[model samples]
Every structure is written in structure tokens, then in C-alpha cells.
Target chain A: MPGWLLTVWAAVVAMVVVFTFLTIMVMFSVWMERKVAGFIQHRVGPMRAGGFHGWAQSIADSIKLLFKEDLILIGADRKLFQIAPALVMATATAMFVVLPFAPGWQVADADLGVFLILALASVTTIGVIMAGWGSYNKWSVYGAMREAAQVASYEIPLALSLIPPILHYGTFSLATATEAQAGWGGMQWYVFSSAAPVAWLSFPLFFIAALAENKRAPFDLPEAESELVAGFHTEYTGIRFSFFFLEEYAAMFVMGAVGAALWFGGWNFPGIHLLEPGSALLQVLALFAFVAKAMALVFVMMWVRWTVPRLRIDQVMTLGYKYLTPLSMAVVLIAAFWEFGLHLIQD
Target chain B: MALPTPPREPARRHHYLGDILSTIHSTAKGMALTMRYLWRKPVTMDYPKEKPVIDQRYRGIHVLDQQLCIYCDLCAKACPVDCIEMDAVRHGKEIEWKAFTLDYQKCMFCELCVYPCPKDCFIQGTEYSMVSEDRNDFVHDLLTWKGLREEEPS
Candidate 1:
């Protein structure tokens, strides 16, 4: 085969694998969320569909949504409205391409991997804005504005907090950070180290920012259903609606992956040499481990979602700017000073 | 006696080191809770394969005892949704009814029909899975006591 053909084949294969894994992950997460919510609320979730505690509920829901009538509004901007969901879904799903599931297991291990993921992740907000504006409805426009503001504001603290970790690890590549943390000792994990207090503080700051980033609860003012009536995608139906759902799950997955990479040591496990670059089976197992860790974080996100009532839009802004942002900056300074002091003491 | 308000501590400034330590402490607390629950038995049921035990008083589908019905329209009057429609025919020489029809489509399953039946003919059953694509499936036929006697004799 020609080199171009080989490259095309590789890209196609990569797309197929990523999409399949994302679909399975979303389905499982949906089922798990329902089950968790049911247990917490003292109710039984879907039980009849495909048995085994409604294992196929998500699949059934997807099929139902697929067959439903696609409703488009009369005054809606036809082109942009249709394109908005596709943009959101595509951008959110694209993040997984650069995500390192395990050592040497990423589809594209670019040097600027983190930057690429962050840039692609921001596209989801643009999609939201477009969906809101294109709908020509007042509520959707408000929702779009709120979502844009929330995401844009939180990204400041989120990116700043992330910087300390990169400074300590000395690389932007996710795989390199994971490699650095590979050890049985607590010192190997960034969270436990004394030199980087910012990294430790960043965990919560990033978590709060991620909630805003993904539009999860407390920061979910954009889609305050009672007020905005389903937010920016209120008019969307059928597969268009499914696209929004896909984007939400994909964003959640990306947030979880980023959290693992930055704070919890991506694919690194104590006493685990199985994640070394050479063995394919080990790489696959490590990838599974990485996903498990991500899903665990996702579970925590769900727990927080269920536990807290959403803050008002202003409160959300205040929390990000007035509290989280300044706190994160202070942490960065302390971490920097601590490192400097340590160097001076040694000298 | 009026109680004096407790003296408040001076407004603590944001300390980066203190905030980092506090965040770590809180996260450790949260992780401890999560770890504790992770090993505990899941509160999930295997669902369809393992049916939950429902209470005996749980209301389900309604069943009519044809032999005991006296062609009275009490059940029809008592139904809230008006889902029940009953038709009765008296045979040539008898005061008792022969044929009867009851439409289940409008039945509210409120147990009102069951309680008001003069002959105690209506009863609620445990078979709740009565979903159907066709509306006609909801209609039911009840045999009169006379019809049962006549069929037996024949």
C-alpha cells in the first residue's frame, strides 16, 4: 500500500475504535447513573428491558430517540440549527483522539496534546452559543450566553491551576506525565508532594471548573430546566437531541480524563509495571485501568450533581472568580516559593 | 436575661498554603468515604431476573367473576374513567342474564367497581402486565350464571 493510503487507513481505523469505545462508555455511564440515582432516591430504575437490571436501557432509549419525529421550529435558522449539534458532538468526541488511555496507546500522541484537547473542548461552548443564537428564541439565547460566560470564566482558573502540574512534570504531553508518576511510593503522585501545593489545590479548583466546563450541577445554570425550559437545545428533537446528549457524555469523559492525567497520575498504578510501553496486552490492560480511573471520577461528579442544588448564575460566577481563581493563584505562588526555598536550603 | 453574642474571630485572609492544606484535607475525607463505600455491597438489584416482592395490598388488574354477576350496571356506574361498558341480554323465560360484555379500556383499576358489585362479582388480580397494541384486546366477555348452567346441562 502507498504511504497516503496507509495514513488514511490508520485514521479511519482510529476513528472507528474511538467512536465505538465512546459509545460503549456513554451507554455504561448512563445505566450506572440511573442505577445510582435510583438507589439514592429509593426507587427502581428500568428493570424489564433486556434483563440484568435493565442493562440495555440506554440502547433502548437511543433507538426510541432515533425513531422519534424530528421537529424543527418554523422561525428557526435551518442551517445553523442543524449544524450546531453536529459541531458540539464532533468537537466533544474529537478530544478522545488525543487522550492517552495508557502508555503508547493514544491514537495521536502530538507534542501539544493538552493544548489540542483544551482547544477542541472549547468548541463545545461555541456550538452551544450557535444553538442558542440560531434557534431565534429568547430563552435559548440567554442560555447560550450564560453557558459561554461560565465556560470562558472558569477556563482561566482551570488553565492556571493546570500550569503548576506541567511546570513540575516539565512536559505538556500526557504520556510523559504518566511515565514520571510510575512508582509504588506516595511521593511519585503529584497530589502528595510538598513541592507543588498548587497541584494539590488544583484538584478541587479543577473539579469546580470542570463542573462549570461540563455544565454539571451547581454550575448548571445554563440549562436550568425550570427557568430556561431545556436551555439552548430546547427546540431540538430526534437525532439532534441525541447529539446534545452525546456531547454531554463526551465532555464528561474528557473532563474525567484530564482530571486523571493532571492530578491522579493518568495510567500509573502502585507496583504496576504492566503499563510499560512494550507489551500490547499490558497496554490494553493499562488502558482499561485508565478508563476505570476516569469513570470513578465521573461517578464522583454524578454524586456531586445529585447532592447539590444548582447555584444562581451570579453565584456561579462569584465562586469561580471571587473564590476559586484567587485561591488557585495563591496556591501557585506558594508552590513556587516552596520550590525556591527548598533550592536555597539545599544550596 | 439577654445573652451576649459570641465574639467573632478576625476575618481570616486567603492564605495559599492554608487553602492548599484545607483542600487536601477535604479531598482525603471525601476519598475515605468513597473507599469505604466502594468495598461495601452495592444497593442495586439484578432487576428483571430477580423480581422484588410486592406487598399483598398492591393493586393490580381487575378480574370479573362471571358466575356471580347479576347483570347489574353498578360496576359501570362506579368506574371513574368510564372504561367499562357492559351489555346484558335476558333469555326468553328467565329473569337472570345470559350474555355480558365488559370493556377494560376505561377501567381505572380503582377498586370502586369491585367493592360496589351487589353480587361480589368483581375482583382484582395480580396480572398487571396488560399492555397491548390493539385497543380491542382490552375488552372482556363475562358468562352469566344461567349461561354457565345452560352450557353445563347441554
Candidate 2:
């Protein structure tokens, strides 16, 4: 195969694989979220959809959404309204291109992986704004505005918090970052690295900021159903609504992937060096490690979602600006000084 | 000749780091509680697959003991809404049971019918699942096999 053609083919294959994985993952996460919510509230949720505790509930929901009649309101900007969900879904899916699941498992493996992810994540804000503006509903516009402001402000802290790991690894490539953690038999995962305890601040900072970026609970002011009635997607129905749902769930996995790659050592496991990277067993184990770590983070996100009440919009902004942003900046400085001091000690 | 005023303290001294630490502690505590319950047995009983344990005094469906019931129309008369209908045919000395139906649409399950039955034939059984597509299915025949199976011995 020719060089460009091979690259194109690889890209196509990766896209297809990622899309399928994301679709299935979103479905599973939806079911898991319901079960988690049910358990938290002391109820058995979705019992009879497929069989044995509603295993097929999400699939059934997807099927229902597929067949549901599409409702476009008279006030809606038909073109932009139709495109908003697709835009959100596309941007969310595009983030996976730079996210490294394992050593050889990334889609694009871009040189500037971190920058690409941050950029793509922000693009979802545009989709959200379009949805709100296109809907022609006051509540939808309110939701969209909240989302725009939240994502825009939270992106700063989110980006700042992730930088420490990139600095530690001294590269923007997620694969390189993962590889960097492979030292010290994976004991040197960036979260625990550096003698400076303040480097640890980045973990929680990144998580909270990521949660806000993902528009998850506590920071979920955009879709505050009590206030805005389903937020920017209020006018959406049927398959279009499902697209937004897909994007949200898939974005969670993307957040988990980025977190795992930057801090938790991606697919690196202790004693993993004994087996060759080419070995099927090693690859499987590496993949398993990566997935388990990411899923654990996702579970924590779910846990936080249920534990905390939604913050008011002002509170959300206060958290992002007055707290997380400053805290994250301090953490970056601490990491830099720690690295500098460590080098001096060696000299 | 101005009056002396007390110095104002530094705006109540906000504990930024301390607040963050406490927030972490409380958030962890909340998450721990939810996590503990996540593994615990769910309070829900799968309704169709698993039946709930109903209390003995729960007033659900009505049961009638054909053998114990006499030709007394007392239960029918005692019904507040005349939902209970009963009839019997007499052949010489032995009485033949003809028809007995309870109109569940109006039956309040007050156990009023039970108190008036001299033979202690009327009872509120625990069979609460009374779903049906037919409107008249709510009118339960006390002489049917289902009704007889639900009969509790006095």
C-alpha cells in the first residue's frame, strides 16, 4: 500500500472502531447510570426491558428513540437545530482521535494530543450555543448560555490542571506520557510523582474541572431541569435527542481516557515489562489495565454525580474561577519548582 | 474631638485551604455512604418475579367458603354499596349454591362484609394482583375455582 493511502486506511479503521466502541460503551454506561441511581435511591430500576435486571434497557431505549416521531417546533431554526446535536456528537467523538487507550491503541496519535483534546472539547460549546439559539425557547437559550459560560471558564482550570503531567513527561503526546510512566515499574504514575505533595493537587483539580467541562452533576447548571427544563436540548426529540445523549456519555469515557493517560499511567502495569509488547497476552493485559482505570474514574464521576447536589450557576463559576483556577495555577508552579529543585539536587 | 472607633478585623478571615480540605472530607463521607448502599441488598422486590410479603391484615381480594356459608343474605345487606350479590336454591332440606359475585369496582375492602357473615365465610385474601383487560373482570365470581382456591379456613 502507498504511504498516504495506508495512513488514510488506518484512520478510517480507527474511526470505525472508535465509533462502535463508543456506541456500545454509551449504551452500557446509560444502563449502569440507571442502576447506580436506582441503588442509591433504594430502588430496582428498569427490571423487565431485556431480562434479569433490565440488561437490555439502554438498547430498548435506543430502539424506541430510533422509531420515535421527530418533532420540530414552529419557532425552531430548522437548519441549526437539526445540526446542533450532530455537531456536539461529532466533537465529542473527535476527542478520541488523540486519546491513547494503550501503547498502540490510539486513533491519530497526534504530536499535540493534549491541545487537540482541549480544542475539540471546547468545540462542543459551540454546538450547545447553536442548540440554544436555534431552539427559540427562553429556557433553552438560558441553558445554552450557562453551558457556554461554564465550558468556557472551566476550560482554563481543566487545561491548567492537565499541564503538570504533560510537563512531567515533557511531551504533549498522550502515548509518550503513558510511556513515561512505564518507568519505576509503573510506581511513578504522574499523580504520585515528584517529591512535592502539591503535584497531587492536579488530580482532584483536573477531575472537578473535567466534571464541569463534561457538564456533569453539581456543575450541571446548563441542564438544570428544575430551572431550564432539559436545557439546550428541550426542543430536540427522537433520534436527535439520542445524539446528545450519546455525546454526553461518550464524553465521560473520553474524560476518563484523558485522565488515565495523563495521570494513572494509561495501560502501564507492574511487571508488564517481562512480556514483549507484541505478545497478545501483554497487549490484552495492558488494554484491561487501561480500561479498568478509566472505568474506575467513570464510576467516581457517577458517584460524585449522585453524592452532590447541583450547584447554582454563580456557585459553579465561583468554583471554577475563585477556587480551581487559582489552585491549579499554584499546582503548576509547585510542579515546576519541584522539577527544578530535583535537577539542582542531581547536579 | 472625634470619638475613637474599634479596629475592624480582616473581614472574618476566610479559611480557603481549610474549607477545601473539609469539603473533600465531607464529600468523601457522602460518597462512602452511597458506595456502601450500592453493594447492599436493594429494597425493591421484583414485583412480577418476586412477590412481596403482604401483612396478614391487608385487605385485598375477597374469598368465600362455599361449605361454611349458609343461605344468609346478611353479608349482601351489610355491604355499604351493595357490591356483594348472593343467591341459593333449596331442594327439600339441602341448599344448593347458585351464584355469588363480588363487584370489586365498588367493593371498598373495608371488611364490613366479613363482620356481618354469620358463617365466617367472607375474608380479605392477600392476592392483590387484580389486573385485567376486560372491564367486567373486576366483578369477581365467588363460586369460581380461583375464588375457591383463595378461600381461607375459618
Candidate 3:
């Protein structure tokens, strides 16, 4: 194949793989949510349907949802209402283009990878707002406005948290950041390094911000079912609804992968040298380990969702602005001073 | 849940450096938990392939024990939905009667009728997968309960 054709083929394969993985992950997340909810309420979640703990429950749900009538609001802006879900899904999936599962495993290692992912993620809010606005419904308008404000507010803290690592690594490339953490010891992880105290603070700051970004619990103001009756996408049904669902899970995966790369050291492990000469088998194992870590993070996100009650929109904003933002700033100042003082002493 | 009002204070902007440090701290705490769970055996049980032990108190389908039942109207009256119907004819000079019908359609499976029966005859079975094409199939009669008891010499 020509070089350009080969690149295109690789991109296609990567997209397919990520898309499939995301679909499975979403199903797993649904099952997990039910199981978690059941346990919390002292009930059994889906014990029948395909047996073995109702593993096929999500599949059945998907099939049913696919056949359900697709509804468009009669008074809504038809074109935008119909296109909003696709926009959200496309933007969310596009984020995976720059995510590196392992070295040389990314679809497109763009020079502005971090910025691109962050920018694309923000597009989801636009789609959500469009859904709300175009629906021409009061509830949807309120939901879209709340969602826009919530995500926009949280993005500050989220982006700020990422800066410490970017500063330390001195690159915008996620692959480069992962490569910097490659070593044989856990202490070498960016989150543990002495050079950047800010790196430690970024972890929690980003985590809370990520929850908001994915519109998970405590920050799910946009779709507070009790208050908004399905939020911005209330009028959406059938495959359109599925698009939003898939986007949410895909966003979850992106956040988890980004978190793994920035803090835990993407594709890096203690005493693992598959990347070294003559260690192809070790390299493969390490690649799996990288994915496992990302999935593990995703699971934790699910756990948090089930554990916490949703915060009100205002409270969500307060958390991002009043609390997390200030804490993150302090950690950054301390880290900068710490590094500066060390340099002076060494000189 | 109510949507709370937005804060009056201006949004705080964190120093870019500090955000990363906190993320690391939180993730470590999170990872510690997941690592603990990963080593522990999964609580999931494969459904169709494996049957779980159900508690004895589990409420399932109801079965009626006819022989022990007396032709009393108490059970029929106690039924809230009136799904249970009983009929009896005076037999031999002793004036004994027998015949009972219970309709599952109106049955709420409340077990109220089972408890009030004077004969201590009604019982609930573990068969929960009862399905019927015709509504009439749900209606069951207990005429054979007496015959079975006679053969048993009880």
C-alpha cells in the first residue's frame, strides 16, 4: 500500500477497534450500574435473561431500543434536533484518535494531541445544548443551558489540572508524556515525582473535573431525570438516543485513558522492559496491562457514579470554582516554589 | 432533586501546576481500592449454567392441597380479588361437601386465602414460571385432592 493509503487503513482499523471496545465497555457499564444499584437497594439485578447474572440484559435492551419509534419534537427545529446526537457521537469518538493505548498504538499522534482531545470533548456540550435548544421545549432549554454552564465552568479546572503535567513533561504530546514515565519502578510515575508537586494535585482536580466532563453523578445536572425528565435529549428516541448513550461511554473511556497517561504512566510498569531489545512478548503483555489500567479507572468512575448522589447544578459549579480550583492553584504554587528552591540550592 | 442557585462568588482559577498534583493523589487512592477488588474473587455467578440457592421463605407459585380443605367460605371471602371460587354438595347423610376452584388470573399471590383456610390445605409451590395461552388454563380445581387423601389413608 502507498504510505497515505497505509495511514488511512491504520486509522480505519484503530477507529473500528476503539468503537467496538467502547460498545462493549458501555454494555458492561450498564450491567455494572444495575448490579451496583441492586446491591445498594438490597435487590438482585437482572438475574434471569440469558442467565449467568443477566449478562445479556444490555444486549436485549439495545435491541429493544433499536426497534422503538424514533420521535422528533413536532415544534422543534427539525434539522438541528435530528443532527445533534450525531454531532455528540462524532465528537466523542473523534477524541480517541489521539489516545495512545500503548507505544505506536495510537490512531493519530497529532502534535496538538492534548489540545485536540480537550477541544473535541467540549464539542459534546455544544451538541447537548443544540439538542436542548432545538427541541423548543422549556425543560430541554433549561437542561442545555445548565449543561453548557456546568461543563464550561468545569473545563477550567480540568484544563488547569493538565497543565502541571504538560509543564513537567515539556510537551503537548500524550505519547511523549507516557514515554517519559517508562521505567522499572512505580516511584518514577509523574504523580510521584519530586520535580512536580503540582502533578499530584492535578490527579484529583482532573478526576472531579472529568466526572463533570462525562456528566457522571454529582455533576449530572444536565440529565437530572427527576427534575428535567430526561434532560436535553428528552425528545430523542430510538437510535438517536443510542447515539447519546454511546457518546457518554466513549467519553468515559477517553477520560480514563487520559487520566492513565497523565498520572499512572501510560503503558509503563515497574520492572517491565518489553520495549527493550528482544522482549516482544513482554511488550505485548505490557500493552494489555496498559488497557487493563485504563479499564480499571473506568470501573472506578462507575463506582463513584453509583456511590454519590447527583449534585445540583449550582453546587456542581461551586465544587469546580470555589473548592477544586483554589486547591489546584495552591498545589501549583507550592510545586513551583519547591522546584525553584531545589534549583537554587543545587546551584 | 432541586437545582441549587449558582454561587455569588467569582469562579476560582487554580494554578495550572496544582491541578495535576491533586489528580495524582486522588488516582492513587482510587487505584488502591481497585487493586483490592481485583484480587478478591468476583461475586458474579453465571446465570443459566449455575443455579443459586434460594431462601426457603421465597414466595413462588401457589399450589392448593384439596383433601385437607373444608368446604368453608372463609378462604373465598378472605380473597381480596375474589379469584378463588369453591363449590360443594351435601354428601351421604353426614352433609359433607367437596369441590373447589381457584383462578390464578385474579390471584395476587398474597397468600391471604391460604392462611384463612380451615382445612390447612392451601400451599405455595416453588414453580414460578407458570405461563398459559388460554386464560381458562389458569383456573385450577381441587377435586382430586380428596381422592388422593383417601388413597393415602390419612
Candidate 4:
């Protein structure tokens, strides 16, 4: 086969693999969140759908959502309303392309991987805004507006926090960042790397910001179900509604992968480097490590969602603008200085 | 003692550092508590597969001891909503029990029917689950022994 054809073939294969992984991950996350929420509330969450703790509950839910009557409110912009979910899902899928799952497992090893991820992730807010606007409902409009403002504000801190990891390694490539942190078994994971306090603090900062960006609870003013019926997707039903739902789960997994790649040493295990990179055992271990870290982060998100109450819109804004922004900006500066100071000492 | 003066304007106290510290502390404490609960066994009973332990005195469904019943009209008369209907044919000295139906549509399961039975033939069993799609199912026959065991008499 020609080189170009082989590249296309590989890209196609990667897309299939990523989409499958994402679908399974999203389904699992949905079921896990319900179970976790049920456990927290002292109730048994879905036990019947798949027999064993409702293992197929999410799948059942998706099927139910798929067959629901597709409703469009009178006076709604039909075109935008229909396309909004696709846009959101598209951006979410695009994010996975840049994410490094394991060594050589990524779809594209873009040099500007982090930048591409942040950019694509932010585009989801646009889809949300469109959905809210196209719906022409007051509640949906409110949800969309809140979602827009929240993501926009949170983006600052989210982007700022990501810079610290790159500064530590001096590369925009996530692959390079992951490779740079290798050597010290698991001790060199940036979250535990006492290169400076900023290195340690960046993990929490990035995580909290990512939560807000993803519109998880405590930062979930957008779909505050009690307040806004169904939020931005109030007018959507059937497959369109499932699209939004799928996008949210996929987004969470993407953020988890990003977090793992940047701070948790994606796919790298203690003594993992000893094995040849080309060896199947090493690849398997690497994949496990990456997935384990990502799942841990996703689990933490679920835990925090069930544990913490949703924040008021004003409080969300205050947290973003007042605390997280300044804190993250300071972290970036401190991390830069730490790098500079280390360089001077070595010289 | 003189009445304590209402604090001039309620003490104005703002401890920024203390507030942040407490927020962290409370959040951590709450998360820890939830984490404990997360690992602990869930309080939920697998409702379908397991039946709950019903109390002895709980009034659920009516059960009748047909052999002991004297075909008295007391239970039918005591029913506030007049849901119970009992009919018997008298043949010489023996009263032949005919039809005894309780229209549960109006019967409140108040155990009023149980107390008024002169023969102590009627009692309430601790069985709450009765489901039927037909409207006629609501009316239960006392003679047929609804929610009762044949070996165990009242």
C-alpha cells in the first residue's frame, strides 16, 4: 500500500477504536455515576436493567432516549436546533483525536496537542449556546446564557493551569510531556513532583477548572435540573437529546485523559520504562496505567458531584473570577520561576 | 438583671482566612463522611427479590375461617362504607353460607370487619401486595379465603 493510503487507513482505524472506547467509557461512567449517587443517597440505583447492579442501565437509557418523540417547539429555529447536538458531539469527538491514550495509540500526534484540545473543548460551549437560542424557550435561553458565561470564565483558569505542565517540560506536545516525566518510576508524576509547590498545586487547580468547564455539579448551573427544566436541550428529544448526553460523558472522559496525560504520567507505570516500548507487555501495562489514572479522575468527578451541592450562578462566577483565575495565574508565574531558579542553580 | 441590649448592629465579623480554612475543612469532612458511606453497604433492600418483614398487627387483606363463621350479619353491618355483603340460606337448624363478598374499592382495611365478627372467623393477614388489572379483582370473596392458609384457621 502507498504511504498516504496507509496513513489514511491508520487514521480510520484510530477513529473506530477511539469512538468505541469513548462509547463504552461514556456508558460505564453514566452507570457508575448513578450507582455512586445512589450509594451516597443510601438508595439502590438501577438493579434490574442488566440484572447485576443495572450494568446495562445506560444502554437501556440510551435506547429509551433514542425512541422518544422528537419534539420541536413552535417558533424554534429548526436548523440550528437540529445541528446543535451534532456540533457538540463533533467537538467532543475531535478532542479524543489529540488525546494520547497510550504510546502510539493516539489518532494524531499533533505538536500543538494541548492547544488543539483546549480549542476544540471550548467549541462545545458554542453548540450549547446554539441549542439554547434555537429552542426559543426562556428557560433554555437562561441555561444557555449561564452555560456560555460559566465555560467562558472557567476557560481562563483551565487554560492557565495547563501551562504549568508544559512549562515543566518546555513542550506543547503531550507525548513529549508524558515522556519527559518518565525515569523515577511513578515518583516523577507531576502532581507528586516537588519540583515546586506549584507543581503539586497545579493538579487540583486544573481539576477544579476542568470540572467547571465540563459543567459538572457545583459548577453545573447550566443544567440545574431543579431550576431549569432540561436546560439548553429542553426542546430536544429522541436521538438529539442522547447526543447531548453522549457529548457530556465523552467530554468528561476527554478531560480525564487530558488530566492523566499532563499530570498523572499517561500510561507510564513504576518500572514500566524498563520494558521495551515495542513489547506487547509494556504496551498493555502502559494502556492500563493511562486508563487507570483517567478512570480515577473520572471517579473523583463523580464523587465530588454527589458530595458537593450545586453552586449558585453568582458563586460559580465568584469562584472562577475571584479565586481560581488569580490562583492559576500565580501558579503559572510560580512554575516559571521554579523552572528558572532550577536552571540557575544547575548552571 | 437588665434585659441584655440587642447588639447595636449584630457583631460585624469577617474572617477571610478563617472562612477559607473552614470551607476546606467542612468540605473535606463532608467528602470523608460520604466516602465512608460509599464504601459501606447500601441501605437499600433489593425490594423485588426479598419480602419485607410485616408487623403482626398490621391490617392487610381479609382472611376468613369459613368453618367457624356463623353466617352472622355483624361484619356487614359494622362496615362504615357498607362495602361488605353477606348472604346465607337458612335450612332448618343449619345456616348454609352462600356469598360473602367484600368490595375492597370502599373497604378501608380498618380491621373493623375483624372485630365485629361474632364467630371470630374473620381476621386480617399481613400481606399487602395485591395487584390486578381488572376492576372486578378489587372485590374479594371471603369464602374463597383470600390471603390465607387452609391449614391455619383464625
Candidate 2 - chain A - TM: 0.96
iRMSD per prediction, in order: 5.0, 1.0, 6.4, 1.2
Interface DockQ of candidate 4: 0.58
Report each candidate's C-alpha RMSD, comma-separated, in the order given: 5.9, 4.7, 6.6, 3.8
What is the Cα-based lDDT of residue B148 in candidate 4? 31
lDDT (Cα) of model 2: 0.85
- Per-candidate TM-score, chain A: 0.94, 0.96, 0.91, 0.96
Where does candidate 3 stray beyond 4 Å?
A1-7, A36-46, A184-187, A274-279, A335-347, B1-99, B104-133, B145-154
Give every collision pair in model 4. Answer: none
- Model 4 per-residue lDDT tens digits across residues B1-154: 8998876886768675576678779988988999988877777788878889999999998888877777778888888999989887776655566688988889888888789777888899998888899879988887864323336444
lDDT of each: 0.77, 0.85, 0.78, 0.85
lDDT of 1 by residue, B20-135 (tens): 57956875676555445545565667654577776666667666776556667887788787766665566653435544555677666678877888887777777666678988
- Two-way DockQ contest, 1 vs 4, winner: 4
Candidate 1: lDDT over CA atoms? Answer: 0.77
Sort order, lDDT high to low: 2, 4, 3, 1
Clashes of 1: 1
TM-score per prediction, in order, is: 0.79, 0.91, 0.78, 0.93
Summarize candidate 2's per-residue lDDT along B10-37 as a digit string, tens digits: 7866699887888899988999999888
Q: Which candidate ranks first by DockQ, i.e. highest?
A: 2
Q: Which residue pairs come into collision in candidate 1? A: B83-B106
Let me know the TM-score candidate 4 reaches against the reference structure. Answer: 0.93
**Tens-digit per-residue lDDT, A228-261, candidate 3:** 9988988888999999988988898789888888
